[model samples]
Target: MKLLETIMQRAQQDPQHIVLPEGNEERTLQAADAILAKKAAKITLIGKPSEIQALANQFQLKHIDQATILDPENYDKMEAYAQLLVELRKNKGMTLEQAQKLVKDPLYIGALMIKSGDADGEVAGARNTTGNVLRPALQIVKTKPGVSVVSGAVLLFTESPYGENGFVMMADLAVTPNPTAQELAEIAVMTGHTARTLGGFEPRIALLSFSTKGSAKHELVDKVVEATRIAKEMAPDMQIDGELQADAALVPSVGASKAPGSDVAGHANVLIMPDIQAGNIGYKLVQRLGNAQAIGPVLQGMGAPINDLSRGCSADDIIQMIAITVNQAISLKHNKDGILH
Candidate 1:
């Protein structure tokens, strides 16, 4: 509850509109009710108003009757958005007819809504696959400059922690597999920025691997070493180090002995795994074995403040996701030039 309140307080400070495309999902609807009640964000649901309202009533979610709901199929700006999509993706062979057809998807429409400034941020995936949400956002919202690869980062609040704060962030967990060194560097930079902006921690990023620097020799260790170099080059002012094992990265005594001179050795707030496999598995292991709270797998490097949710997430999970999205939106709002390197 303390963790939830910390996020909620920050989110409500400069409230912004958040669009939810999974309006028909009961958890999403219930979360919307909680969001509205908390006054932490303005709610917009992407679905037919009648149908969403019916479900909202069925769930007995407060403020549901008054929540703004949009039907992608019948939105008044559908033609204009289709034209924009065509123009935006003309290099990809998007015809107006095809754009018009794609706009029928709530995901696409929600992306367009953010693209068109109808909303500040977007969240979905309660019932959709990650690609279902990511594809449209990638096509419509795109990536911020210099962030060529988008990744997933989950913020873990632990019973006992290794991050500078009491929380840890693991990256590339739910998106982008087998990233190149440059791509991994960009992901690390984004995760560090996310830790500061959303996780309330001054970021110390550890580029994680199976071995501490020069402790073992493998292509995998080489990959982490190269990535660490690029991450340093990318964000010179940021504290980043590693080619570190999980133990060396998170355990203070081990970090001190293994990588004695590194600033991020034992106090990393953000952990950038070597690849998606390591990231996905590492986060889940900590989440289950360490009694940690995993809040995201949040989509980072999108042009806007859109996020994805686990399909199995509860209503409380949705609320927290919205809070995270709000923080991302605020960070973007305050720094349009770029939130981080």
Candidate 2:
């Protein structure tokens, strides 16, 4: 299938609300129009109304009828919510006025929308840093029950022979720079959950390192070992292994030889890296050199599936990320229901 087709498939599965925190109104309006036209999801563009309208007019784009354009300046209903947020973050050395000022930001407001159930999920970071995109979510949306750290997941796609497609997930590429073993374990568990949610399968997670089954000795390898142990203890039902090199994790022959009886040796769908430097470089290498279609450095482990888009992302990228976010939201809701039942 084509990229657009895959996007539409995911979008049709869960048409939740998607908030875009763009800098300029015209671009945001254009995005809103595209999302609505495609019947992808409910689009909410956050910016100044007048500026957005002017850009819509200038671009000869019809006003998005179904779209809700939000201006941070006019979100009066969120005042109480913002004040609460200020109080919550007071320990971070922010005064009430300072907190109020920060909460007025589009990023903070977008996060509040999710927290308040006004939006199902959000996609931001076109003009914001990864930290900027995640900070508000961390502060307001918070982590899930028992979740201590937030991480990132990238969906790597490639076409195999016979027209089949494959997916591999990498974690902590955009979030933690130097994750401790405990943090690595958290990332592995979170990435596994995300993969199962969006990729629609039980994920075999591999905690990747330079060594495979203790063949190499290094601090990083030790970290992966401890992380794999922690992850297994935390998620006893999850299929996970670690201290494996990429070749052993991905190649059937190498895995069969290196890890004789391991479950995740060659069939791992989720890979947790030791640090951001490796995760970032590895994903990009696969995308650029190996010609894989990389969908995300998507933020995960938060209360919701709030995502980030590269500033150079196209309208199609926004559409696809929105679809992924919607799927995540639905899956999360479904899991919650199952637990309650």
Question: What is the lDDT of every predicted structure here?
Answer: 0.86, 0.78
Candidate 1 structure quality by residue, lDDT tens digits, 157-231: 886756754678889998898999888989998988887787565688899888898989999888888999988
Q: Give the winner by lDDT.
A: 1
Q: Write the per-residue lDDT of candidate 2 for residues 232-319, one digit (tens) a residue.
A: 9888878999888888888778889999899888777788888999999998998898898888877877888799878777766776
Q: What is candidate 1's CA lDDT for residue 254?
A: 91
Candidate maximizing TM-score: 1
- Per-prediction TM-score: 0.96, 0.91
State, as a TM-score between 0 and 1, how close model 1 is to the true structure: 0.96
